[model samples]
Target chain A: MNDTRQFHLLAGLATGRDARSDDAIYQSLWEAIVEHRLSPGARLPEDALAGAFGVSRTMIRRVLQRLALEQLVTLRTHRGAQITSPTPSEARDVFRARRLLEGALLTEVVGNIKPADLQALAQIADQEHHASREQAIRLSARFHTRLMAMAGNASLSEALSQLISRTSLIIAVYGRGQAGCPCEHHTLIKLLETHDLAALQKWMHEHLTGIEASLDFTASGDALPDFEHLFGHHREQNAS
Target chain B: MNDTRQFHLLAGLATGRDARSDDAIYQSLWEAIVEHRLSPGARLPEDALAGAFGVSRTMIRRVLQRLALEQLVTLRTHRGAQITSPTPSEARDVFRARRLLEGALLTEVVGNIKPADLQALAQIADQEHHASREQAIRLSARFHTRLMAMAGNASLSEALSQLISRTSLIIAVYGRGQAGCPCEHHTLIKLLETHDLAALQKWMHEHLTGIEASLDFTASGDALPDFEHLFGHHREQNAS
Candidate 1:
């Protein structure tokens, strides 16, 4: 398989920087990778990425660096960059860390969640319920962020956000890529509504464990989960 | 006060790039600020810094970017960079975050501590006992990393490290520069030594609160807390 082919074909015909922000490029790339439109081991060559995103190499580098910082990409010296293929051990570590943090995060999130925040959360669930599967997935991921923001600890939220990106990469590389399923959001949301802090915390832990269990890290193979369906189908609109 | 003079005067006669690395430069600069030789609001012009550190403008920018990332420096668009003067609210936010993470971190650390790790903690305390106050301060700060490293969560440790650096900058700006008193380290080490998880956790909370209470955030004006005595007499070796 051509390592760069998936990213190259997905690049589309973006031309010029006037309209595309690094953030837009970053989000599109982020969506593409998580959704599996851009598969694991896909090359992120600067020139190709620059042309693909309608930005300069410097701009592309900025995006790549951010991805690299989060371990979504491995920027090699002369080898350019590729989506991270986490080893089985690394896959386990990422999930372990996630469970530790999110489990701890929920105690405070539940204790501190106000009625207005609960209503906003119900609104998120409504949006997820009404939206397409892909949008549901995106909303589900955003649900966690909303919870974190409400938790009111910038440090924990920031840490978990980075871990979530890494978890997406892990799912891309190791887990089945059905990462955004809306299974646990409502359970926690309902728990929060009733002010059941203990169960909310317990539910949060199980939710993360469930996510980890979905990854087939026990079996050894570099299989590509289908991209278009895993994350969402927003790329056609997002690909500049 | 010449804005650049503090850093400029502290910039030693570094000859060329071959003589120094960015890490070395960063450590020197870190020690200088934490030790109070380079006061808050000190200007860090690229050329002067480049000349002083004997590195490329790119190298200097890399170092500055790191310090900026750690919230020790503020990189304005065209105004260049200055050591950050964190507002009182930012100061409080940092401590609040620190208290949450550290308290959470202690439970895991105590559960995971190995005999060798305990010995290493003792050794760190011993070094602090014998070293100069500045070195003791540095060691005390490092003791936290060692504890977190043993906790074995890279995500949590990484988050706390960034918070610690920001906390140091907060202390530099709002608290006395004497931020590294060896107050909490040995006590926590003792608690960990005895495997007292509950006390360890409680101590970590009070430890952080005690540190926060030590800062004088409500007082007005940006007076340079006389750098030498506040931190230590370590600058002659570190000023460059």
Candidate 2:
């Protein structure tokens, strides 16, 4: 909720890791964002993050740049970085993409799902039942990403992973006390075990559809641009 | 091709542009790479590129970092950056991803096809006919990306754009005297005019299949990674 609490969550994700590499920092920050510990529009000060992670500002800058590219973070010229708040249109785009991509990918997953794969997925679903709210949401994303990876297309998997991460941001912004997946992931796991292609695809479709339907798009207006912060440096240079 | 020739093509792309900003430099280098003017595994030295583009090496590094994120360029720790050479398996993955994503997206294009959209697509296809080989390949990628944009999903459009760019890399790697899309984009344009969803989907599937078929996957082995180049910095540190 606050920066200190958010950094604590990141520390938990980074526990037992002494030397925080780029990936470790990125993963910790990403988890905190997707888990809603770091709410949308929360500023990510370079010094704060660098101090929290015991890394240099250069390392934090690299991680921030990567996250900015993935759209989970927004970096302005002079305004610094913040967790991205997905617009209503971007939310719709993410859901539509998930349905079209995840639904189609389920067929490949159904065709080639091994028993071990099913077990691994079920384990994640089971873990979600006891996870904290943040952990549950992250696990939900992990479930979908892991399931889709069965289709074995690295490009789709990678792209969907980004969408999945953004879906967390969307849920944080528009969700009215609703979970990202709740119990639906377990049911989808069951459908995978059944191996009915039609059933699996149908469930995947309705599952994504149901999640999209639950979001309250009208609740949030687009964040007004900070024109002062945007042009303050230009004004200073001109005055000088 | 030589670095001089590659930089010349980049210069042409950057023509009439004095301020070679990051996007300008990125666009020029991206065009060169996708157009096959910059071959797979071509080294992109920072000093040479900075001199050619008249930008700081820092700016060039940022652009290269972006391309590296998109998988168009590979940046090693000590080896600097080079154009990505997608492997046989990676090529197959790209084709499969295209068939699934593009085939699904065409249905949306058919559902929302407009006369003007079709005309615009036709214009790109028309230009492809008269363009040189490199220009034609870039135009063909543009046509597919443009058509998919009509589906009205920014997430899918952005994801597909990355895949389309990588497809250019794939084609450069394994193409055996073949064009990226040749003349099939025109047929796709015609189908969009007709608004036949089923036909459009089928045509897309076969069109992608044909492109994948034309690639000579068996002809090239994965580039034996330069191990000495990979670990050269570590060895130098130890010796020091």
Candidate 3:
């Protein structure tokens, strides 16, 4: 897909704007990376990204630096920037961290969950059921992030969301077919509706463990993805 | 105090270096803020900091940006950067986050605690006991951060560490006299030695809650600190 069309789809933009906010730019790139449209180990050339986003290279660099801080992107001394390829060990650490965090966060979720939160989660689950693989993966991250946000702890929710994003990088590296449990989210929503913290925690632990288990760590890494193919269309559009 | 002297003491440097790595610069400034050497609401002027660190404004700006990402510093449009003066609500959110994270993380710490880990913690507690109040506060943060790192989850450790640093900022704004529980680290170390996970988690929760309770959120905001006094010494030295 062309850059504008892809951004429109990924960012869910109704109409094109001349210049995007830093957050809008970050969100677009973040969603693209997490949804696996931008593969792990893909080079994010600043010039091409600037061209695509119709912004300065400096703006692109700022977004990349923020992503690097979240561990979704790797910035090297001279090598510039690339999507982080989470090592098998790093992948396991991410899952273990999630199990501990998301599992513990259930107490707060149970304490604070309301009908509206349940409805919100159920809606995400429903969307996940019908999305394409990429969209489903993105929706699944949204599901967990949204569920955890109901806990009313912004710090925990923010940290967990970063982990959720990194999970996409893990899936990019080692996923065989599924990046997230598309069907299982509905089950989670059902469990949440019950307000059984133990059951919810148990289910979350098993669910994350299952997703981790399903990954093929034996899967090899990606070769550098084609940035030109990804953003060349935008560069052309910008030039025109 | 002079910036060089402050850096020397805060970073514990034995010798002066011609240049500091970004991490080194970040570490020095981070320690200063968390120790309350750099008060909340203190302006971190780029030119002054660049001179103090003997680096380019660009390098100083990068360090400031990193600090901003961690929420220990706030960067504003046209206003430049300053130490973050967290609102009372933000302070409470930070404590709540720590209670959830550190308390939950104790399970992993208990599972992973070895004699060396305990020894390392005890050493920090020992230092805290002998250190000045500022040093003690910094050591206390080190104590908790080091303790959490034993959980063996880098992501959680990193996330919790940021919260711990922000806790310092919270103390800066709302703290009455104590920044951290200077005397409690030894107690926590003793609890760790007992290997009682539940008790350890309980102590951690109470410990963080107590610190939060001690803060006087009614405290007035800081006046814009005298940057000329804080960094001007280094400017003169640089010119010489």
Candidate 4:
């Protein structure tokens, strides 16, 4: 019994040690936002968050600052941080910018894609198609993100990443259940593998247009959940 | 004497009111970075800057965070912030991304240019041709920035603004003064005015290529004094 307990303790330590503080926080917050676990306009209190994450407020502040920079969170003076809730006009602008930036990225990387990259993208598409839970949304978002990454331009990739995050925010606030068939990804991969730059560009543009057209921008105040439920974990920990 | 004092007071108020704050710091810092006033690896101390700007540490932190988001500055855990000195490879990647994004912007906006907007762009080129000293460089940079702005996408405009600022930083650090004639701007304006979309796109690609080819990229340690003098006023104010 003593040996088993010691082994369990060592295993837990190893698993905990593998998680870098910042990355873990970033990933958790990102997932929370993407999964709608943390709703739009929900405040992220640094001290409470620090307590929940078993880290310092400084780390939470740093991660929140990074999120603010990405426009995923809005950092206001004295009021603290909240998940960004993009206005309708801002949403339209986000998609328009994505069309331009992602279109260019697709055009550049289409001709350069290796068979392995195409296969990897196909796998993402497959996962996105079969995904029943919230992971589907993230996988769907990552599909375009991975394409931008494959372009191998760090600046463009970083910009696209921010745009994609904001896009997810917009979707969370305004998305309608206009789900359709998921064959667009396969078609895109085929076009890319065939080295058809013009077709790839057209398909990518249409893909974004289709996604934007599917959004419901009319919803307003119904977007924000009450602060208590959204941030209950922090409140509970603080109370404790 | 009363009138004169009031006038002096108003002027002083205007100057003091317009004095650098968080609202203005980002642009000022951007200018400094582009103009090589801030060298890569130079530390930005919050207390020192807050005292200099007559603002709180919060405001300084906000501005530095903005700069870091633009990749113009790097923020470390305990080491404070420093101007980003991108590697040569990063510089190349910046240009490549510019080519793709700006090229697409040119293609899309060429056909949509209003006659008045074209005339305004031509006027800018005319001013650039006659500009002396820093006005010339400022005008030259504005020529490209204005074109992107005219594309009617705020997100693209913002991204391009950051790119231009970074390019200026790169030039200040590595440029060898291989300045060329300003004919390309004239030609680009002519193509746009003539509604030659294909030619406009081609000219833009060539223009960016020409600018890249003209970069000196050989200067070493030229950024130190530039940054020192640029922020020296703030230092002196604090010291006094």
Poorest lDDT segment (10 consecutive residues) of candidate 2 chain B: B1-10
- Specify the CAPRI tier of model 2: medium
Order by lDDT, highest first? 2, 3, 4, 1
Q: Tell me how far the alpha carbon of residue B114 in candidate 1 is from the true structure, in angstroms, after superposition.
A: 2.9
lDDT at position B70, candidate 3: 89
Q: Tens-digit lDDT track for model 2 on A26-59?
A: 9898888888888999999887787678777788
DockQ of model 4, rounded to 2 decimals: 0.45
On residues B120-160, what C-alpha lDDT tens digit does candidate 3 reach at each position?
Answer: 98898888778998888899889889999998989989999
After TM-score superposition, the amount by which residue A202's alpha carbon in candidate 1 deviates from its true location, in angstroms, is 1.4
User: 2 or 4, which is superior by lDDT?
Assistant: 2
lDDT (0-100) at residue B73 of candidate 4? 89
lDDT of 4 by residue, B1-240 (tens): 112221222223223653465656666556555545556767677766665555677777878887888888888879889888776677888889888888888766875788778787788889877866445565677778888877777777777777777776676556676543467788887777787777777887887787788776655443344667568899899999
Candidate 4 lands at a TM-score of 0.75
lDDT of 2 by residue, B1-240 (tens): 225444755766776555577888989998998888898888899877887787778888888889999999999998999999898878888889999999989878877887888888989989999999989989988998999999999999999999999998888878888676657888777777778889989999998898888878766534786668668999999999
Docking class of 1: acceptable
- Residue A61, candidate 2: Cα error in Å is 2.1
| lDDT scores in order | 0.71, 0.86, 0.82, 0.73
Q: Model 1, A1-240: lDDT tens per residue?
A: 323344544454233344477667788787676555666787777876776555578778777877776677788877899888777777776677777777776767777878888888878977887877545655666677788778677756777787777776676666664545564567777777787777877787778788778878755534466466656658866875
TM-score of 1: 0.80
Q: Positional deviation of A88 in candidate 2, in angstroms?
A: 1.1
TM-score of chain A of each: 0.78, 0.88, 0.86, 0.80
Error of 2 at A174 (Å): 0.4
